[model samples]
Target: MPFKPSRRHLHTATYVDNKLYILSGFDDSIGIKGIAGIAGKQFFYLDVSVPFNTQEILWHDLTNINLVPSHIGAGSVKGGTNNNTIVLCGGRYLANAENKASVYTFDTRSNSWSIPTIIGESYIRRRRDLTAIINDDGKIYLFGGSLIGYNIVVNDMLILDTINLSWGKSSTLNAPIPRVYYGADLLPNQTIIYIGGETFVNQSLTLNEVYMYDTINDNWSTKKTSGSIPSNRAGLSAVLGLDGQRVIIFGGYRNNRIISAQDSLYTLNINTFEWTIPKIFGNIPGPRCLHKANLIGNYMVISFGMGYQQSESDILLLDISNNDEYKWVINFNPPISSSSPTSPTSPSSPTQIFAQKSAAAIIGIVIGSLISSILLTVGIFFLYKWTKNRRIQKNETSTSDNYNLQRTSVITATNNYNQSSQGVISTTLTNNKVYNHGRENEEIMKIHDNEDNPINDENIISEVTEIKNHGQESISVNNNQSSSIQNINNINNIDNNVVQYLKDEMIQVVRQEVNQLINSDNSNNNY
Candidate 1:
């Protein structure tokens, strides 16, 4: 039982739950162009759980539940907290009319589609052939796409907050050149990596540069890749590996008319920024462009695309579970009806042979350069760490010196206070002792002549009592001075400890920033 979709292109497919939803695209078989090109209104889905050869392998049409008109090249994303919702926005339906900025949503749980009210003051322009990626924060990011009616590509980045059902332009700076039909994939670190796309500049040349958008920081950076670089192409399909460490790019068109529907497959290691063509066994799909690749478990399912001679309806699968080897299998082949187009023969020309050899050489060079770059990056990182550590040590030393100075000042103040209080106590004690001795002598002599000197004895006794009270006050002042000196020493010690703790915290923060910088650098290289 062969299941096939109508010959179409410029469509979008998204995998949700266990099904792949194939949306509107231009159907050349219909040969009908009203305002826009011949576009299909039917919505089809396939149960991926069933084997491809099984009779159950068929696409179920859900167009009755869909209300929106047919469209092509719409930006879509599967988002929401549960990832059960698919939102499509901004596509072209009629060539003469303005591009559709209307937003539509499909609930996977209910199998229903509905238009959602967009609430925002910012004008959301209608675009087609745009790329949209969903972040972990439930926001869909739309990148460069063409303004259909105007025939202009825009570089504006828009963000749709799913939680609020609102749209706003992102404040990302230094974005890539405005282009369409680019290959894009999101990394685990919330960065969107965009590969080659066709730009209108220089008479519509394909771009080979790689650009990365940091979703967290709202910044863009260019990555320089070394290796057998793939030819500048657009309409390529990129799928991230299950481990989230590699991106596999397949089938794209090189010049305006040249389609790269061959056996060549490129794999990029995100960690090392390396590209390698893995040896694939079994039947390989023909060269094609504008295809969709979906990673399901250990298998990669590539759907319909424009092949070398005609539009392809076959589903190709590549088993990547084995790291050492890959097995390619054609999962589904559509039934050959009279309406099916015949496959054209692909001849290998001398130019093609030379191109292949050149590509191989480039791959060799890229591998060599990638290794060197990795080594250099590692070395630079270690050097940076060493420099940071040295700086931290110097800062700690300076802080310690400051702490010692502060402690010394506090100790000096305490010593001065102690000396002054001791001097005052000594003077008061001497005066009290001298006065008490004189009074005591006088009182003792008066006691001998008690009958004649009663009034003199009483005066001497009062003077002696007053001297003793003065001595007690002097002792109390000395005790207070000792306690104050102890407190000053304690405070000085606490201040020193606080300074040390602050220095440590500063060093920790510096280390953290350095680590973040290194990680960012590594990620950019992969982009």
Candidate 2:
């Protein structure tokens, strides 16, 4: 009961000239399968400022006119820019051949109905539940309806010129399949968005798709929107707002079962081809199908639905004045003026109005600031930490370059491991290493003076041992002992044996590590 109910089974609604007009639908009527029964073909109007919770709507009984019937009343009660009249177009009469291509008008100033002369070539007979939309240019467009008994549906788009009072069909090319009970709305760019609905086929299949019609190009296109799309349904309510840049849709029925009636609101952006789940708060009206919603000023007046038991007569007014806040304050008052629906002939307290607006603004500002501060703090902290870490990394990298081991120096420090002709020739020929290690009676070593002058080594063997213990490469090499060592080096060569031994060891280590990594990945995958 988040959304209060005022009346039920109200079919079509439209807002024009600061008033909401709700038109004919049914409530509490039993289906007789073969025989037709009476329906609630009543039209009611309310001042846009009235809060919805008020009972006893200043209802003007438009039902007394022998014109409208209770069946499937599709289309809208559109108003012209400079005109005071509201127009209603083709829908079924719910009873006999009464379902004709009938057009009617409501003069707001006089608060009465005037049945207009039918303008179409052949009257749209036996059709029910079509879509009607009025563009900014003051022309009304009607799309898609069905002949009830024959089950024939038409996809032709028709226009009713408000200025000329004449009807014309679009000469523009191919169109979508003829469908009825589909949700439709006009975008600011004059593109018509059509959502899922039942087809004209014998089977009542619920479609999950979206199509758009361009009024200018006379072309149709499809859209693949993200997030949830409402299930295929008939009798759902759709309106263009959140300020004409977006569209909001609600409640519908499928298979005679009511679904998607939650207070959830979905939005679509015209410029970006993106859909959004806007945050809505406060009281949300429950889902009900066969109801019509009209945008009056800053709110939507939703009236009468057949989704619930007892065919509700609840007239719910939804105030979406704050689109950024994404909240809807609903009042379930009977048909009344928008300004004072709850209080009859009473003015809102001035102090209360000021306090409410002031509190809302304060709350919005506080929430906005908190979110901003959280995001700003996170960004600043990360930036500071990143800068500090980057500086440390640069310092570490510079130090390593000046101090870490170079491959050439490391090899030179290992005595070049060349003590024979074979070792000497391998080093000179390929610059490759042999891994054999051995003790030698004679070893070559030289030293440099503090002034960087080459100094002769007094004892080659001892000097070489000292350099080996340093664990760092020595550049010193003996010039005098080179000839003497060359004779012994040829006899002591073991290059091939050392090279084979090292290769085997390296291969073993690489195979072991690769096996370990693969095993680890497999275990993680299993877990």
Candidate 3:
């Protein structure tokens, strides 16, 4: 077949699976029903192949992988998780509904097309003329695009999970005000960076601010830009370079107030959040926006955007190596096939002795497994012992539902409960005596009136029971005062008397548990 004049506009093309896949765009010839004059359900693929023994490059049209026709929007082309599926999300296109939100996927392996069954997108008509970016993990994001009959762009962001065919909205706050024809990129840490889009106004102006979206944290942060900033221009192109660590932005428009091409390039260190204008080495491509950029090896293949008089710019190469060496190299060579051995070697030859010994090394794996099992058994035994003791300690902890009685010193330091509520009185307890506000010389007092009334130590038990009937609500009123009295006494009393009682009880319980464990271990050892 000779060169056919079947052409299209406002379409999307992506370089994937060693070939370029083309999808829906504006097609006036194919009109049907309400979708007449619209590029819907019309698409094709071109395979970049070099015929055997040929020196020329040829694009073979593959009829099997045609997709629905759709218009090209800002940052819509993206690759999937395995780099095997190319996902084309929201882009502006004229349809029966003027512009429709239609999504489709192209399978590289089978050269087939399918409208991915995505969740939460059934009612969404279209997300036309939007800025989008694909993160490192292959999640395609669409943000800030104009819908049907709307001159203003939207601030909503949607995420399409390519791996699972699920669509969800990300929580991004303080997003850049909605605009169209913007530049977008994904940083190394998966933060989506957006810049420079024209807003809807009588005198439409381009944005100078830069906004970043942290996909992992679902938060947005704005960077305060300083120094020489690029001219406010829309339709600029940006691509992530150096393993997504660096972002390179090129072309858009400037002070002319008209859509013009620009050669100025800017580099942003995604890690440091810094921008730098680097010097170009050789011939650089003239500034152009609404263009597409694809990273092939170390070079970026940039092409296809409106230019002055020249509507479609020729494909240019931006070399992102050490220096800003830019050139326009478009010829793509076919990948070479791997060479196979001419003759088969015998397995029993003397040269194969090393291979036989390597096979025999599998026995070492059995020995390693046995040793691992022994170590695991020992580890589990210790873990079980530790867990059992922890459980016993947790069970023995005192569980009291009673309110504690406040001592007289605690009540006085708190100034009859006035200071207690206001938080003016802070205290600590040492040897049952209160120390108030870092001061010394506070006296200890008996909580109950035992000596004055002929109430003996036996009465102490009854008074304690009565206080225990009160709840924590009453205790909250006195806790601050009680804490202050705790530090009044010396350290020896806390360490000797109070500690000795608990230590003796704990030692006896541990001894009994250890004896039982030892007996069990002995029984197992004998078995």
Candidate 4:
């Protein structure tokens, strides 16, 4: 609800105690010559719980703290003993330097950052744009990200025990290929689900495979998911629903010939491994990549990112209290093309209309049958009760089953009012077995990989603010290199390809819907 942070991408935002904190990132507006400047030292936060229109929402800047120059692809998490601290992991500094394997923690209570500590063995290279997740045990898991300067992507898994303050490598068999800029989320089962990310083999390749890692067994397995899979893209935001049964995936950039951002929303049912695109109502945010999404209560908050036409500062909220449908709302509407089709709108084509009708008919039939069964059962129950009362008073006897039922009812009545009144339906059903926290912790690990440019040959400093002026100068040198310029060109070409790919996918989806509608119509005519 506060004034949005400066326009940037590759930044991380986490919600803690109803407050949102945004870390350093890249701001294209501060480019040196023709190269973009990385805003690593800037930090800001807002009290998200404040009503939007009541008070003037203002961003509180805390950029004066000494911080490492790690902007792009940095991994961050908020989970300490108090759950008030934020931990930032590996990332690059500048173009000439290597990726950092350092770790830093920010204490909200003290309003200070801990000294940077190098993580892992000397042989382990620093990485950026990696994903990180913290389990109930407070251990952070680091996953795939790229090495600085080199095109190498590391697939090795690393674990940082926050309690002991030590790093250990996870020996996982059959891990996914090394990647960067991928989307990841921790499931209720304690397993981590990794989605799309890009890797460099001979050249840059985007991946679509789903990789699942079992923290308990320290093993990896590829899941065969059904339904319409989304196109391969990097920097997508994935968040586990409050119920932890479903995961919501939002916008990301598809690197092809041209960089194109996606605006669609997809959901994955963890139990069934089925992906579905639900119709969202309200104002939808435009296509963007490198944004952050966090699950707070029943709302999925989408923060800053780079849009298709420009950078964005708006926040989008996707309400997931109801799995049957979704509602999208944004904090503010930034100026974009009026012709853009990213706004939330119902599917209105003939095919979509027919599908809706068919679904409604099926639901109506099921409801009618349920009501009929309930009425019949009630009638029989009343008749039996009357008959029993008429003749069973002398023969009536106390039974253990009846006593148990009475006890259960008494217990339910006593505890019902104590349950959470957040208006959200509990994902865990009454019939489901409750799991202990220790067992859930043993089931999963969190892994993160991100990318950042390392600063030239300078000693990694205790005072990170000293290198703030060096960022622009380093970008100027990077811009002069022939190879660097060529790489930039290649990235632009990939973006073009992304746009074309999105267009083709849209056309294909429309065609498939039409065919399904035609088939349904034919079947009805035959009947």
Predicted candidate 1 versus true structure: per-residue lDDT over 1-527, tens digit per residue: 44456756667788776677888777746652223356877688876654565223467778777666788778777875567777887778843433244678898888887777778824776788877788888888889888766888888898888888888877657887788888888999999888887876523333334788888988898776655567777878888887788888888776664454453478777776677777788866577777677776677777666653343344667888776667886554322221212221236866667545643543344334434543444454346435644654464455446556765787687766554322232212222121225543543211122343222313221111121213322223243345533443454355445434544553344335434543543444345
Clashes of 3: 26
Report the Cα lDDT for residue 349, model 1.
67
lDDT of candidate 1 at residue 342, scale 0 to 100:
22
Residue-level lDDT tens digits of model 2 in 351-455: 656545643543344334434543444354346435644654464354344333443465677766563422211111111221214435333222233332112
Q: lDDT tens string, model 3, 244-331?
A: 6777777665433434333357776666656677665554445554555666555665644444223223345556655443444444
Q: What TM-score would you give candidate 3 relative to the actual structure?
A: 0.55
| Native-referenced Cα lDDT, model 4 | 0.62
- Local distance difference test, per candidate? 0.64, 0.56, 0.52, 0.62
Model 4 agreement with the true structure over 346-428: per-residue lDDT tens digits: 34877667655764553344334334543444454345435533432322222223445665676688787665543221111
The candidate 1 region of ten consecutive residues with least summed lDDT is 460-469
Clashes of 1: 6
In model 2, the Cα lDDT at residue 325 comes to 51
Candidate 1 runs further than 4 Å off: 1-4, 31-36, 54-56, 95-101, 201-208, 308-313, 331-527
TM-score winner: 1
Q: Show the colliding residue pairs in model 1.
A: 227-366, 228-362, 228-363, 261-287, 261-288, 262-287
Report the lDDT of model 1 for residue 80. Answer: 56
